[model samples]
Target: MEDSEKNIELKINQISQKLKEIRLSKGYTSYETFAFENELNRVQYWRIESGKNITLKTLLKVLEIHQISLEDFFRNL
Candidate 1:
């Protein structure tokens, strides 16, 4: 893949890992529960957690569910 693609992939992985960590730390037992709490479908939540290229709206929603702003999310990294 191109360097840009690789960078985006890495960012996606990092975001996914962060989300997983937050979910686990919050006592979520399953992705399905996480999805339900976030108002998303299980498969859609899986796709986000798997680092698939999701829409910006979906990304924002996930972060919002975690009570994180886009700026804050990246700033802490």
Candidate 2:
């Protein structure tokens, strides 16, 4: 893969990791529980946490649910 492609993949993985960190910090042991409690699609949330491509709107919504700003979420990433 090209360097750019690799970088993109790395960033996606970071985002996924951050999301998982947030969920765990919030005391959620299961992604399904987090999604269900947030009224999000369980499969979609699972896909997101698995480093799949995500829409900016969906990302923003998820961050909001976690009470975190995009700037904060992406900080030092």
Candidate 3:
């Protein structure tokens, strides 16, 4: 794979990991429960947590639940 591709994949993984950590910290041990409670599409939420098809809209929804902004979402990086 190209270096750029690897870099992108790495970033995706980082974002997924961060989101998972946040979910756990919020007292959700199950992604399904988190999704259901948050009114998110379960499969889409799973995709985001799995580092798959994460869309900006979905990320924004999660950030909203966390009471954070887009800047805060990226502030860790």
Ranking by TM-score: 2, 3, 1
Write down the lDDT of every candidate, Cα atoms only. 0.84, 0.93, 0.92
Query: What are the per-residue Cα lDDT tens digits for candidate 2 across 9-48?
Result: 9999999998999999999999999999999999999989
Q: Candidate 3, which ten residues in sequence have the lowest lDDT sum?
A: 68-77
| TM-score, structure 1 vs. true | 0.84
- Clashes (backbone N, CA, C under 3 Å), per candidate, total 0, 0, 0
Which candidate tops lDDT? 2
- Using lDDT, rank the candidates from best to worst: 2, 3, 1
Better of 1 and 2 by TM-score: 2
Q: For model 3, how does the per-residue alpha-carbon lDDT over 1-77 read when each residue is reduced to its tens digit?
A: 99999999999999999999999999999999999998998998999999999888888889899887889778966
Give the true-structure RMSD of model 1: 1.5
Clashing pairs in 3: none
Q: Is candidate 2 or candidate 3 better by lDDT?
A: 2
Please write out the lDDT profile of model 1 over residues 14-57, one tens digit for every residue: 88888788788889979999898767999988887888867789
